[model samples]
Target: MKYTDTELEKTLNELGKATYAGEVDVVDKVMNRLKEAENKEKFSIQKERKVRWTIGTMSLAAASVALLLFIGNSSSSQAQNENDGMAKFISEIYNRQSQADVVYYTPDYIDILLGIEGMDENI
Candidate 1:
């Protein structure tokens, strides 16, 4: 519905006279709620960043642990290879030649401590 100019002027004058004294309080309460919401949003953003950082750090630690474990396994194999000498094979030959004078060791006992012979020892 449309109002005449006089009615509009009268309405403006009544509003200027503060016929709604409680409206300012309502506006302040709404502004405070909006500020609280903004603060909560900022706090949530910070929390999300912390979670992302924690996840990234944990992943990095896990990857480092895995790499260290892999390196340890490789070094252990290399050490076993480096220790391969003539003793075990010589012992095996002597054991077969004189079963009592030398110990009658099993094929597995005579297996190389490092090489593929350990996997399936056939003397």
Candidate 2:
């Protein structure tokens, strides 16, 4: 309902001044909530730092392991590739139809055979 300012003031005066109904520590409650929020924020920040450190450490370890595996496998594969190239070259040279007879044993091969037979030691 609409009322003039003077009528409103007269009504309020008849109602008397308002009084608080109960004991309420609003300031303490607000301060306690602030403290709890700050503590929660600090805890979350520390947890975030821990998670970052853990992820960083794990990533470094994974990279290190990958590097070691690559280096190790590369050296072994290089040796294998060299051996394969030499074998392919020898097969091409010695096992051809035009050069089958030229694939006969050499003196070094005969010596190795004699040593395997225990005859080179006697000689």
Candidate 1 residue-wise lDDT, 1-123, digit = tens: 899999999999988987654634478889999999999999999999999999999999999999999999999978776555455667656656576534455444455432557454444
Query: For candidate 1, what is the TM-score?
Result: 0.47
Q: Clash number for every model? A: 0, 0
Clashing pairs in 2: none
Tell how far residue 6 is off in model 1, in angstroms.
31
TM-score of every model? 0.47, 0.58
By summed lDDT, which 10 consecutive residues of candidate 2 come out lowest?
Answer: 94-103
In the predicted model 1, the residue pairs found to clash are none
Deviating ranges (above 4 Å) for candidate 2: 1-21, 96-123
Candidate 1: worst-modelled 10 consecutive residues by lDDT: 105-114
lDDT of 2 by residue, 1-123 (tens): 899999999989877877779987789889999999999999999999999999999999999999999999999999999999878866654445345454466545444533555566678
For candidate 1, the lDDT comes to 0.76
